[model samples]
Target chain A: AQSVAQPEDQVNVAEGNPLTVKCTYSVSGNPYLFWYVQYPNRGLQFLLKYITGDNLVKGSYGFEAEFNKSQTSFHLKKPSALVSDSALYFCAVRDIYRGSTLGRLYFGRGTQLTVWP
Target chain B: DVKVTQSSRYLVKRTGEKVFLECVQDMDHENMFWYRQDPGLGLRLIYFSYDVKMKEKGDIPEGYSVSREKKERFSLILESASTNQTSMYLCASSPPGYNSYEQYFGPGTRLTVT
Candidate 1:
């Protein structure tokens, strides 16, 4: 089974400060990780993904995530936080079910981020 | 731009009523998925279709069914709407092979069962 965990239910950060929303996962074989952001009443927007190679992956809206195989973690990061950055964040892992061609994703519970001015 | 549109943004229904949630994607992707979003559950897959008339059960498929008569359209059906089944439903489509790693999502439909 493949699953992602977001320990924090909510994270608060000041404007211009670096922020991180932690995520950890468990999966068989190589892991494929992704991050997405959702604003109120809107669908989730893809942020970034980590398949292989470089540990750091940059994504939309000045956001990035570090994929650590040893730690089984893919934590979302941003150097500067803005008030508008407040939204819901989700971490997901790709699961290619054995004997199946279609790919499936397992997502974490989600993290509510609040960036204050 | 890859556009995935749902039939409605919000809906209200009575228990035991049959409901249909439609999703159409213009990207011509080979895979389409349905998921329910709850506050603490994040997103749980309900069903997915990789080709016309071909569907697969997902992590949570009880009380729900799916249809894919055409390449670009995927529909979710609730045989009997229950209060506990009320949720925000999301539809997504992804290309085949390598690019399938990412999925494009629709605006989502919020369903309320009373």
Candidate 2:
């Protein structure tokens, strides 16, 4: 089974400060990690993903995530937080179920991020 | 731009009534998925279709079914709407092969079963 975990239910950060939403995962094989953000009453937007590349992956809206294989973690990061950055964040792992050709994803419980101005 | 649109943004249905949630993607993606989003539960997949007339059950498929008669459209059906079936449903589509790593999502449909 492939699963991702967002340890923090809520994270608060002041504007202009660096912010991180922690995520850890457990997978049977090499992990394909992804980050998505969802605003109220909206669908999730893809932020970034880590497949087979550098440790750090940059994404939309000045966001990035570091993939650490040893720690089994893929934490979303931003150098500066903005009030508009407040949303629910989710970390997911790509999963190809046995006997299935379609690729699916398993997401975390989600982390609510509040960027205070 | 890859656009995935749902039939409705909000719906209210009575218990025992049948419900249909439609999704269409302009990207011609080979894989389309249906997921129900609840508070604290994240997103649970209900079903997915990788090709026309071919469907696969997902992590949570009880009380729900899917249809894929065409390549660009997928539909989720609730046999009998229940109060517990009320949720925000999301639709997503992804290209095949290597690009399948990422999925494009619809704005979502909020369904209320009373």
Candidate 3:
């Protein structure tokens, strides 16, 4: 079974400060990781994904995540936080070797980020 | 750009009533999925179809059914709406292949069962 966990329910940061949302996962085989953002009353928007590449992958809205295989973690990061960046963040994981699963992703409960201006 | 659209942004239905939620994707994706989102549970997959007339149950598929008559459209049906069925329903699509992992999502429909 593939599963994702977001340890923090909420993260608060000041404007211009760096922000980080933590995520970790468990899978039977190699994992395909993803991050998505959801604003108020809106659907989720893809932020980035880590299939097989460098440890760090850049994504939209000046966000990036580092894939740490040893830690089984993929944490979202931004150099500077913005008030508009406040939203709910979700981490998802899929086992690439599980063809029987049909590309299904297991998602975390979500983390609510608040950036103060 | 991939665009996934849902039929309704908000809907209210009564208990024991049959409900239909529609979704359409314009990117000609081979896989379509239906999921229900809750405040603390994130998203749970309900059903998915890999091709026309082919559907598979996901993590949660009880009391729900799906239809995919065409390549671009998928519909979710609630056999009998119940209060516990009220939640934000989301639809997603992705192309078939091992390399294609990200799934594009619709804006979502907020369904209320009274």
- Give a tens-digit lDDT track for model 2, residues B1-114: 889999999999999999999999999899999999998999999998888998989999999999999999999999999999999999999988755799999999999999
Model 2 residue B66 distance off true place after TM-score fit, in angstroms: 0.6
Q: Count the backbone clashes (under 3 Å) in each candidate.
A: 0, 0, 0
Per-prediction TM-score, please? 0.98, 0.98, 0.97
- Model 3 alpha-carbon miss at residue A107, Å: 0.9
Compose the digit string of candidate 1's lDDT tens values, residues B1-114.
Answer: 889999999999999999999999999899999999999999999999888999889989999999999999999999999999999999999987744799899999999999
What is the lDDT of every predicted structure here? Answer: 0.94, 0.94, 0.93
Share of reference contacts found in each model: 0.75, 0.67, 0.52
Model 2: residues with Cα > 4 Å off, grouped in runs: none
DockQ per candidate = 0.79, 0.74, 0.65
Predicted complex 1: CAPRI docking category:
medium
Q: Which 10-residue span in candidate 2 chain A carries the lowest summed lDDT? A: A94-103
The true-versus-predicted C-alpha distance at residue B112 of model 2, in Å, is 0.4
- State each model's C-alpha RMSD to the native: 0.9, 0.9, 1.3
